[model samples]
Target: MEVASVLHMNGGTGEASYAKNSLLQQKVMSITKPIRDEAIRRIYNGKLPKCLAFADLGCSSGPNTLFMTCELIETVEMLCRELNHESPEYIIFLNDLPGNDFNNIFKFVECFKQNLNTRVVGGIGKCYITGLPASFYERILPTSSLHFVHSSCSVHWMSQVPKGIENNKGNICMASSSPLDVRNSYYHQFQRDFSLFLKCRARELVEGGSMVLTLTGRSTSGPLSNESHYIWELLAEALNDMVLEGIIKEDQIDSFNIPVYYPSSSELQLEIEKEGSFTLNRLEVFEVSWNAACGEEHNDNSEGYKVAQLIRAAAEPLLVNHFGEAIIDDVFHRYQHILADRMSKEKTVLLNLVVSLTKTT
Candidate 1:
């Protein structure tokens, strides 16, 4: 699949839109708030430039897109207030693939900027935001332009599906059914993609500038572990059921695989070091439910229903692109039932990785 052309959350602020369904990622942003604040604290301690650049990559449309930006502005504002330093002008870039719902964000962009100006500038510190549609795997801005870069719940997406996995049947992601070679293909793909990410960011960031990334990843149990692989396992089972009933072709299963990988903490560190561009300041790994921050009391849906909504919001675009919209409803319907059944037995979660880095060159 041409993922860049296809991959995006359900656009607009409607019910299925990522704007409403991204609470899980908003929780991630909250979790990493301290780390982000610390990075900004250091920047302020050194120098709060008169003009600065900040970019959030894979910043899919949602309240979380502007939500993160708000936190960033707040961090600088709070730090300057505490330190008695005047605030600076900001060139904020919100980036995602071309298919992202920039229109949704644009609808309220001027209002958002005005709010920031009123709160931060007081007619003094000017803040600007622009939407840049492109993959974060490549350079998105001029060299040494960005002072702080942030991305949450996005880096796990591989730039493309792994090569040489066509023979691995019935599985869309790395799971128990995947062969050893197929797993290796995913690992190698992540290595290449993440290395290029760090290298490209290295060129874009000023020396001593910081970056913090939070995304779904794996634990010590490795890539094939149940905790790491259950989401896809259930999804594949749902598709296989459809195949059994002839709702979809078996070959479609073979051809359609998700371009997603959850890397281990070690895998992440290895790529950063091998890329030889940034100094890894801190690394954190935490476990959050596939349904994290989602509460049963708020809705009547089953746990599986909630989880399915979360995954569907983030992944439905890809499913629609590959399978056509005809089976979209049926696939998720079966997927919710399968996931609900699975969650009934045990509470499973994803291992999350948060890394803090500073550009050295």
Candidate 2:
């Protein structure tokens, strides 16, 4: 499957759009607030620059997209106030796939720049914000132009499905039952994608610049850990239920594999070391309950429904491409029911890894 063509979140401000459903990711980025601030401080460190370059990679359209950019600019503004220097002109790039909804995100840029302008004690500087439609897996900007980089809830996505594991036969993602070779295929793909990502960013960032990345990841139990992959496991079950009802073919499920792979901290560390571009400064894993970000209580299975919407916003386009648009509602309804039953019995949490790294000399 061509992931970039169909991997975008549900667009616009609809109830199911990623704008509303991504509060979980917003909350995750909030937890890393200090990392962002510290990285900005490290960049200035008494010597304020005349121009600052910032890039928000994988910046999809939503409240979260502009919300993220504003935070970065605000961080710089606060630091400039402390240093008694004029706020530097910003070269901000909000980047995503070519198919992303750049239109929605651009609407907020004017307001973001105006807000940043008001706080500057002197006249406003040029905070140039523009969208660059390209994949971060390869070079996206000119060399050594960026001073600070930030990516949240991206980079776990592999550029494409792993080779030699087309069908994954009966599974859509890495699971406890997956064969050793299938697991290795995913790990190797992540290693290669991550190394290249670092390499590209290294070339773009000025030496001593810092990058902060927050992405979905696994805790212990290794790369094949079921705890980290329970969502997909439940999804596979939901697809099978649809098959039993003859709503969709079993072969469809057999041939479908999510183009995402959540890596363990060890795997992430290994790739960063091998890439030899950036030194890992701070790496941390946090456990977040599935229901933590969703506000409403779920005595009536509403929690399951919300979980389905959240995941659906991100995964539906791909599902539509493979299973046809006809089955989306039915498939997610089944998934909602399955998840509600499971949630009523116990709690499930997904691990998120937040890392701060500095470009090597």
Candidate 3:
């Protein structure tokens, strides 16, 4: 499958859209706010440009997109006030795949800018927001153009499905049941893709500019040991249940794989060192309960249902591409019951990793 063409969150502000289901991602940004703030502050102190340019790579549509942009703007404005320096003009790039919901994002631009002008203390400077539809795996910005680069819950996505995983049947992701070769194939693909990511961003960032990235990750060395695997494990179970009931064919499940990997901190460090363009300044690992971000607002929904909706908003496009749309709802409904049972027995938490980097070249 062409990941770039099919990989996008459910668009629009409807009930199932990413805009409504992205509280988890927003919570992650909040968790890593200190690192992101420090990086931006470092750049401002080192050299505050007349027009501060930055890009929110893999910035999917929603309140979370606005949240990141607002934080950046507010951070700069606060700094300017304390330092007694003139506020710099802002050039913010909202970047994502070509298939992303750029229309929805644009709808918020005018209103967001209007609010910024009236809300920020002492008022803010001129701010320009643009939609950049492209892949971060490739160079999408001019060399030495960005002062600060930020990406959240995005870089774990592989550019494409790894080759030679055809044998990884009965699983939709790298599971414990996957063969050794299948596991190696996934890791090798992550290594190549992440290394290229660093190289691409390295070229786009100015020397000494900062980058902060946060993604779903694992605390342990084993690839399948993370809670992220349980998401797919339950998904696989749901598919298997359908296969038994003749809702879908067994071969269909065997033929599909999710193009994502959750790397351990050691693995991430190794890739940064091998890429040789950016210096890794700080790395941190944190955990969040599966239901922590959604809160009591979703109390009417079962714990399993809440998590299912979150995954559906993110994974529906990909699932629809592989399986027909007919079985999408059934799949998640089954997944919800399975997850609910599991979570009831034990508290489940997702591991997250945040890293800060500096362009050295």
Name the best candidate (by lDDT).
Answer: 3
lDDT of 1: 0.83
The residue-by-residue lDDT of candidate 1 on 184-204, one tens digit each, is 998889888999899899999
User: What are the lDDT scores of the predictions, listed in order?
Assistant: 0.83, 0.83, 0.89
lDDT for position 68 in model 2: 77
Candidate 1 positional error at 213, Å:
0.6
After superposition, which runs of candidate 3 have C-alpha atoms over 4 Å from their true positions? 298-301
TM-score, every prediction: 0.95, 0.95, 0.98
Q: What is the lDDT of residue 271 in candidate 1?
A: 88
Ranking by TM-score: 3, 1, 2
Error (Å) of candidate 2 at residue 266 is 0.9
Residue 196: error of model 2 in Å? 0.6
In candidate 1 the C-alpha lDDT for residue 123 amounts to: 36
Candidate 2 regions exceeding 4 Å error are 116-124, 221-227, 296-300
Candidate 2 vs candidate 3: the TM-score winner is 3
lDDT of 2 at 270: 83
Q: How well is each residue in 187-214 modelled by candidate 3, as lDDT tens digits?
A: 9999999999999999999999999999
Model 1 stretches astray by more than 4 angstroms: 117-124, 293-302
